[model samples]
Target chain A: MAVKYYFYPLWLRFWHWLNAVLCILLILTGLSMQYSNPDFPFMRFDLAVSIHNITGILLTASYLIFLVGNMITGNGRYYHLNLRTISTELMKQFKYYTLGLFRGEKPPFPINEKRKFNPLQKISYAVVMYVFIPLLIITGWALLFPEITIHDVFGVSGLHLTDLLHLIIGFFVSVFLIVHIYFSTIGATPLSHFKAMFNGWHKTHD
Target chain B: MMIKGMRIQALIWMFFFMIANAGLFAQQTDSIPENVKENQKCLKCHGNKYYSYYNDWVEGDVRERMNPFYVIDSAEYYNSNHKTFTCIDCHSYEYEEFPHPGYLRMEPSYSCMDCHGFGDEWAKFNFEEIQSEYEKSIHSQKHNETFSCWMCHNPHEYKISARTEENIKEVIAYDNAICLNCHADIDEFMFIAERENPNVLETHDWLPNQALHFKSVRCIECHAEQSDTLLVAHNILPKEKAVKKCVECHSDNSLLMASLYRYQAKEERNKAGFFNSALLGEYYVVGANRNYYLNLISIVLFGLVVLGIGVHIVLRIINK
Candidate 1:
């Protein structure tokens, strides 16, 4: 058996980990503020607010960096949404997860330099990266700006609709996490996919 | 003969004295002629003569009259419950002449303790103590100058129904005005704070105005109740409890609560580990009080991170 070489560049790995950690922190503090029960007083309300704002700014900056880096590195090609290929790829990935993977088969698609994500992953990541995350950042920043004014952001005066949109997008991210976990388990072994992410190599019977 | 003569003389003298006294008594009675007639003459101008004495004389015509002293209603004395009793019944003193009301005239006033004989018990009511404490309160200093014992506990209408929603709203509005009157600066400050921290959603434009903030929320909104079991009090709550209280209104599409929650959540999370899932989730369902769907997203994010790391580590060990 030889190991397949699907290199995740050092910058990509760095950004991925940083984004993951920061997003987790944001979500945790965010939830605390939302529920605000006595038991969850990880931070005082005022301090949590400052931290959430700072972290949000950091996340937005990092996301921009990632975007620019991808474009510069020519890795942005991986994000293209080709409908014909994506539709077929998504169907095949679904079948593998639902039936084939359970029957001790390999994944229908393989990770390579050109195609980093399976069809489902590509579509989901595109939505999260281009659509949802950007919307969240804009709304979150607009919320921060007293000058921008909530009315200016959404043609309204209060944060109700804005909060709802933020939460709804957050929900999508959570669903993505669950499916991501399940797929990780479907690797060559329960832990193999996780290992590949770190070492940038996967074992395959040639 | 001398003793007998002395006795007869004494008896004759006693008899004469008795007759003379009787005649004098009758003449005196006739001359007085029951001054009730004179009192009736005075009553002609005094409306509702019987209740006149009970009227709030301090605020009544007596205080308003240009003439400091005018007895327009003597009927109050004649037709009162003490009608058979003279003015001296309660006064216990008589006016010898006009303009000289008397050296020590009792004021027409009574307390519940006076008639009920609860003087001893009334002393233990500790009203003075409560009044002193209230006088020192921010509400007292900011609002009413004459914040007496009767201000909150109206002596005439001392009922707890003052806690009703309508009454409370009125009180809150009044109390808020007190703050505004003194601290106009707070309104602008809050406006800036709200604008700066609009939350992740960009829905609203400005924070609620000073009037809306005070009336809609109170000091207790952020400061928890003294008693843990009390859900709400004086419209304030402990910060944690306040957040929970907001759920009653903000959750489930409640615009106010939702906006407040988002702003708060972001703010709180920024400060410290106030809402770290690893810490708070074990105590209770993290999302039960939250937007459940959003919580799910958080969980998923967490799971993905875990999976990514787990797969990476395993593969590394195997390859090595």
Candidate 2:
């Protein structure tokens, strides 16, 4: 028996779980604060705002740390797109999800040290981590200090455009949340993918 | 001798009767009260016609409207901080006599230091230093020609509440009026005129190079109200709140509120066509019908909750 070794790094595990928890909290408090309703008793409006700001700062810091860690550990290379391989892998995964899996077919893409995520996940995470997250942070900072030199960084016209883009990106994140939960259920068993996230390893049944 | 004594007695009786009559006349003259006398004096100068006009106006009203120069809500003004003060309180000793000519009603000035007992502190503070800075402002230059401090701030009523939608519209209108007052071509300054004008590149010597589109935009539209003072400042929302505000406007559907349920199903599709159809349906067909979407969303959310719990249990078993 050839035992394949694929261990999740300690840093990756920490960042993943921290981001997950913070993102959830951010969404909950964000929803509560937005509506200004008394029903969501998790936190008061003022406290929720405080928590959201603090959490946002922490999330930004954590993302920076994650970026540095990824660069140092060479994990960033996994995100590099090879069009042919990606297209092929994505199609296989899609097919498995839609039709093949019902017939008790095995997952076409195997977990390896170099390629942990499916092609779709790779692309999604790449966009999320590299593009959307950074845009959101920059726009958020600009919005925070309207009296400051935000206009210098991006001109007045550009700032307004950036703000609109930021709002669209936020809508995208909400949609991502709904889709992420749905995809989390698509493993061999409904809980398999979730368990893997916690345990740092998936149990492959032969 | 008896005739002379009788004459002296009659003279004494006449003098006593005269003293009693004088007392009765003095009481009658002094009987008119101060208020009545003041009103009569005011009528003398203002004319009986003015008095009648005032009387007709205030007959059914509790407010006393003496001045017609400014539109004053007398009831609200009387209930304010200056309630105890009469018209003459600030304008004391202005009128030397009834119908005094060239008498100017003194403009009420505010001194926070007076009531606050910080007179010494204020005395040392140079108003000229701050006034010089304000004088340099663009707002100050335009304000000089068309309007004064009274245009924006009520001198008597210094404290103002948060800018309401109506007040914001009024402020914008005032800004437009200020622009038109200086600009010779009033049509050039008007929003619709600017849009229609073919000479967009033409530089008018009369008008400033800065665009007047800002005059059309309401103040509160861009500036958010500060949480503490309710005054519109700059962007004051924290990142989380900003994100939340963005979501509140942009989110197609929200599970957090009952109001958002109508769009919940459309939200899940991630299809532009579905959203467009949903929007059309919502506007044209659904109209006020929201219960259908609400019930559907509740069911879906309930299912999600149950699935999450079930997944949690399954994960626990797998770990074991």
Candidate 3:
């Protein structure tokens, strides 16, 4: 028998796709700005700057939605995984992926009403949503209005540090994006996880 | 009888004409600014270079230089910041006499602080702070009496271009001209300097993009002590004490801010936003004002991501 869980709500599904589109736009524009040649540019420098700023603002708004939605609904509890069992659970999941998955053994921790994500998914998603995104947002805003930033920090300029942090975090987010897409394919079927984000139902075989 | 009557009338008319002429001349002179209308009387002789000559001690040697006291470039004076001023406004009233007395030559010339030092009109220019800074400068420290405000700023020709010019490049060129006039020209340098005038180009050869640097910023930006309250610093540091470190102007907290870009920084409401919008504007400083560590990190991180993905795909295939 196959079980269908109403995991992704309409709002979450909408916000996810919106964030994905925005992230892609930001990445492209960001790369254009940092690496593009003045004469032969990937995108016109001025145009890329405008698009990046607009998309970043949109991402900020979308992030706020995720924050508020998590606060008001039960979705917040899923990210609050136990730190005590995390190491053991993470190792078990890591082993299962590397060994048991190829051997066609049963998943160590399958999705349930109580557990929306396995340990690996929970940890990575938690880090991306709670830590990396917030850092990127704060640094991005600091860069936009640098007057508010400290004049210097331990001899280095605050603006320089803020810009550097923003770039580093953006790079991490880009990496997470690639891996996120790759891991999404490793479900009951290749496209099952991607399909679940659209139709708001996660169908799994028991 | 007719000749006698005509002679008598002519004598009476001549007497009345002399009295009226004297009264009219007095009235006209009193109606005009006494010193203002007299510039032509002075410029007629002073404006012509060959009209006067003087021997002055320059660098301990007697040099027969043209008497600057009696000769001035009228065209330059007309174009100066004090173009509207009368000569007497800054000089003694005794100079109106011909063959000026030997004691009159000893009369002290007015400093910029004499008139600009007092009153609410000049309070906004921070002339007091400028004076204080100038007092501390190497010029003042070494040659207190010899180097007046006229040395760096010839009030006769200086137009306050740094404060008034619409184009910054023009301001830069005009400001540097003052320094180069003495530093670069051998004859001019000889007037003050005891040593040989070294080639300015060779002195600044260590600076990358020497021509661009000269055009981009005033000489004071590196050579002067920066003040938080002053628009342009007056404390001219000695060449040995001048900023030689590349990072002084190249780093994020560039000295250019305290010197060259101070006005723009003060005026900009949003500092980062202003730079962002003016990415291709005149404010853009390439190579100097840049942070590349993040860029390098971004490249390395991206490369690692690709490598990780490649290994992941290979591991999956092996398992399959």
RMSD of each: 22.0, 24.0, 18.0
True contacts kept of each: 0.05, 0.00, 0.11
- Candidate 2: where is the Cα deviation over 4 Å? A1-4, A38-43, A148-164, A185-192, B1-320
| Candidate 2 docking DockQ | 0.02
Model 3, B181: alpha-carbon shift in Å?
A: 22
Q: Tell me the TM-score of each prediction against the true structure.
A: 0.48, 0.43, 0.50
**DockQ score of candidate 1?**
0.04
Q: What is the C-alpha lDDT of each candidate?
A: 0.52, 0.50, 0.77
Candidate 3: the clashing residue pairs are none
The true-versus-predicted C-alpha distance at residue B147 of model 2, in Å, is 24
Higher-scoring candidate on TM-score, 2 or 3: 3
Interface root-mean-square deviation, candidate 2: 13.3
Q: DockQ for each candidate?
A: 0.04, 0.02, 0.06
Over B58-98, each residue of candidate 1 has an lDDT whose tens digit, in order, gives 65533222232323334334433335433333332443233
lDDT for each residue of candidate 2 in B1-320, tens digit (9 for 90 to 100): 99999999999999999899899988986985553354334434332223322344556523243455444444455434454444444444555343344535444444332343345543433333334433444445544454334433344443322222233334455434433333434453342224333342242222221233233232222222222211223232322232223222222342111221222332543232222233222121111112344335545865775676567546545543
lDDT (Cα, tens digit) per residue for candidate 3, span A1-206: 67889999999899899999999999888766655454444776556667988899999999999999888886888998799999999999999877787777778998889899999989989999999989988987876655567756775557666765776778888989998998887877779999999999998855
Clash totals in order: 39, 0, 0
List chain B TM-scores, each candidate. Answer: 0.27, 0.30, 0.73
Residues A45-96, model 1: lDDT tens digits? 4455567788899999899988998999887888889886777888998887
Q: What is the lDDT of residue A135 in candidate 1?
A: 86
